[model samples]
Target: MRGWIIYKQNEMLLRQEAYEIHRLLEVAKEENIELQVFSPDQFDLTVTRDDEKSILIDGKRQELPDFVMPRMGAGTTYFTLAVIRHLERLGVYCVNSSHSIETVKDKLFAQQILAEKNLPTPDTMLVKFPVNVALVEKQIGFPVVVKTLSGSQGSGVFLSKSPGEFDDLMQLIEATSPKANIILQQFVKASHGRDLRVFTIGGRAIACMERNSNGENFKANVSLGGVGKLYPITPEIE
Candidate 1:
């Protein structure tokens, strides 16, 4: 059967999702499953006679694949999900269905879902316009963590110890990306400079690791120069 993997080409250089895609493709090739890369830039959507169509690369005319894997990044979110939904409408399977993926990709929304499911998570608050920095400081207290609503690899995460510091940082961020919205949260002091990196596939933990940050860094993301040690998954992780 034929399948396509869709992902942002630019982010493939450093993202772990890219590596996961490569591994899946390698396995597919070994198993004799037809696999192909479907980049967003290589296709255009059109609707004719109440039927949707995609114009693919190399000027080839083709129907949708048997399945699609969306490894898209934040930048290509809307288009990637649109394509995935289109494929689903055409009877194609998607690893994470568009709606489910969308829910997880949204940080605040995901936190809410987890909270509803009684899963433990850091206390978080989504903030928009008319934000009162003083009120936020009073509630979450000093040394709070701020993050953009949509970011990966700790790109938009920041630690602010004071209202003035938070304002300054927000000013800088606004000057750069004016459209950005953010979330404020109580920093997990116990988890300071460390966290568990658990990889789950098909609802099972496949790989696990413990990551510790370098000196003075709070984020333990490997992309941010943190060191990681492979660990066996305990019952808690599972």
Candidate 2:
């Protein structure tokens, strides 16, 4: 069987997890499976055929892969999702559905979905035009986090420890990025300085790690030079 792996090339710098794609491909090859990697811009969905036959592109006919592994990052956005949709139409199995990816990419939407499902998540607010910065402050209070609507690897995220700080940051952000909407959330004190990073696949935890930031940094992302240690997945984590 053949498979296609779609992912962002630049994400390798911030999140080295894309290296795992190579490992996965190696395993697939060991099992005698053919795999191909394509950058988001390389594929053209406009000329794609729907039948279970090969689609011609650039004078070459290529069969639709048996499955597609979407390791798309926030930067890929619409193009990545478009490729997934095209593959789905051609009967390709995606590791994570396009809708699921989209839902998770939107921080506010994800929080709402998790809350509706009775999943524990930090309190968050979404602000659009005519920003009600005061209302957000009254609700989530001080020491809140402000994150871009679409971001990953802890980029475009900021913490406001007080009302004055929050206002100053918001003003600066608004002046620089007038078109951008922000997601403000009440910081989870319990998870402060640390959090659990659990790799879950097929509803099962495979590997887990604990990340603890340095005393000077509040963000515990490994990319941020935070210390990490392998940890066993306990019932509490589940």
Candidate 3:
């Protein structure tokens, strides 16, 4: 058995010590599966005149893996997605389908889908220029959470404690990126300094953790100085 993990080569190299990739490789070894890692740029895709699809890795034809796992998250670019799509065409199964990844990359679209499914989601509104402060006050209220449409690891996220702060932040954003895509969400005070993180595979919850802010920031992201610990997976969390 063989598999591939698609991640940036540079990042993998930098974090090679005590990284998730090493753990995955170890598990694969125990299972008698030869798991390999490849950067998106390593593969060259081609479609032949006879409708045959072929991919070359490092400029040489190579055997396809039984499955692929794209782990780039927000770092995933159009080219990366294109590579994944090409892999799919060649009948490679990918964890977290490309379509789902694309949809969730857009914050508003993901929230809308969750709400439509009757999931309990914070009230969210897409922001537009010549901003509607009145509507925001009435609908979302103060102390809102502002976020860029596509971000990960708590980047491009901000908390506006009042109308003035929100206005100032929006003006700054407009001055720098006039056509920036942003969203406003009603802040959930109950989860202010901490939140539950759940990991799922095949639609089943496998692990749970709690992330707490470092007593300074509102975002409980470990990359931003947050602390994490194992947490019980209760029925409600599931």
In candidate 2, which residue pairs clash? none
| Better TM-score candidate (2, 3) | 3
Error of 1 at 27 (Å): 3.3
lDDT of each: 0.78, 0.77, 0.86
Ranking by TM-score: 3, 2, 1
Q: Candidate 3: deviation at residue 204, Å?
A: 2.2
RMSD of each: 3.5, 3.3, 2.0
lDDT of 1 by residue, 104-217 (tens): 778899899989988788889887555678888777877889988887777888889888888788777777777777889999998788989889888789999999996688
- TM-score winner: 3
Predicted candidate 3, C-alpha RMSD? 2.0
Q: Which candidate number maximizes lDDT? A: 3
Which of the predicted structures, 1 or 2, would earn the higher TM-score when compared with the native? 2
Quantify how close model 2 is to the true structure by its C-alpha RMSD in Å: 3.3
Q: Which residue runs does candidate 3 get wrong by more than 4 Å?
A: 10-14, 49-54
* Positional deviation of residue 213's Cα in model 1 after best superposition, in angstroms: 3.0
